[model samples]
Target: MNEDLTFLVLRQLQANPKQTQLQLSQAIGISVGRTNYVVRALIERGLLKAEHFRNSKNKSAYAYLLTPEGIDTKARITARFIQRKRAEYDALRAELDQLTAEAEAEGLLPQ
Candidate 1:
């Protein structure tokens, strides 16, 4: 999975650990197979831990949680994600400004 997806999955897990793969897939707009693959990768990388427990509904389920290392990684990745998005936003803002100026110069833009 890409860094963006990894960061998103980690963030989602932090938000709700008890969510099932299907639920996560639906929430994240990814396929169930991709969610399953990502979860397995995280487990193998020691970034996430899957604990089986019986929920209040009396059904066995897995709660995907982050380990200490995972938490630390998540923090770092979140920072990076923020930086990337901010840079993209800045670029878009700059482009919009340029486009507006050009349009205004040509009298193609409304005041």
Candidate 2:
């Protein structure tokens, strides 16, 4: 659950990291409380950081940004995700091929 939440938050942030927590919650369709919880966890994990700055419209707001360590961790997590996906794809392909061969041998598929 944490991994899924982290990935979802990362994807959302990657899209528009300048968004405030409220804005991010709106964009991501999550409750503000949930977003805050996840964001805080990410910050604690060293996967995110924020700097408060006065916007033209709001004086007490923050903009979250990824640190160098955050970027590195993102890269690593993305790579691992792709690798796992590829492995699943390969496994599915093998299973499909095996099923096809079995069906063909059983005259269930066209020669």
Candidate 3:
């Protein structure tokens, strides 16, 4: 999975470990199958732990918990994600400003 998806999964799980795969998929705007794949990959990487809900009658129900390493990874990923988004935002703001200036110069927009 990409860093953005990974960060999102970790974040969602951290917020609510008991969320079903479908819920997670909806939250992340990904297919349930893709979510399953990502979850399995995270588990294999030792970043996440999936434990069955013993009290629940649904044997398939599980709680996805983040390992310590997963928490650290999430923090790092979050920082990178924020940095990338900030750069994108700055670029977009500059572009918008330039567009506004051109529009004003062309009398297409009021000053």
Highest lDDT against the true fold, candidate? 3
TM-score order, best first, reads 3, 1, 2
Clashing residue pairs in candidate 2 (N, C-alpha, C atoms within 3 angstroms): none
Candidate 1 ranges beyond 4 A from true positions = 55-60
Q: Deviation in angstroms for 111 in model 1?
A: 2.6
The superposed Cα distance between candidate 1 and the true structure at residue 17, in angstroms, equals: 0.4
Count backbone clashes in candidate 3. Answer: 0
Q: How displaced is residue 102 in candidate 1, in Å?
A: 0.8
Model 3 per-residue lDDT at 44: 99
Estimate candidate 3's alpha-carbon lDDT, on a 0 to 1 scale: 0.98
Q: Can you tell me which runs of candidate 3 are displaced by over 4 Å?
A: none
lDDT of 1 by residue, 2-106 (tens): 988989899999999999999999988999999999999998999999988755564658889999999998999999999999999999999999999999999
Q: Candidate 1: lDDT of 68?
A: 97
> Across residues 1-111, which tens digit of lDDT does each residue of candidate 3 receive?
699999999999999999999999999999999999999999999999999998999999999999999999999999999999999999999999999999999999999
Q: How many residue pairs clash in each candidate?
A: 0, 0, 0
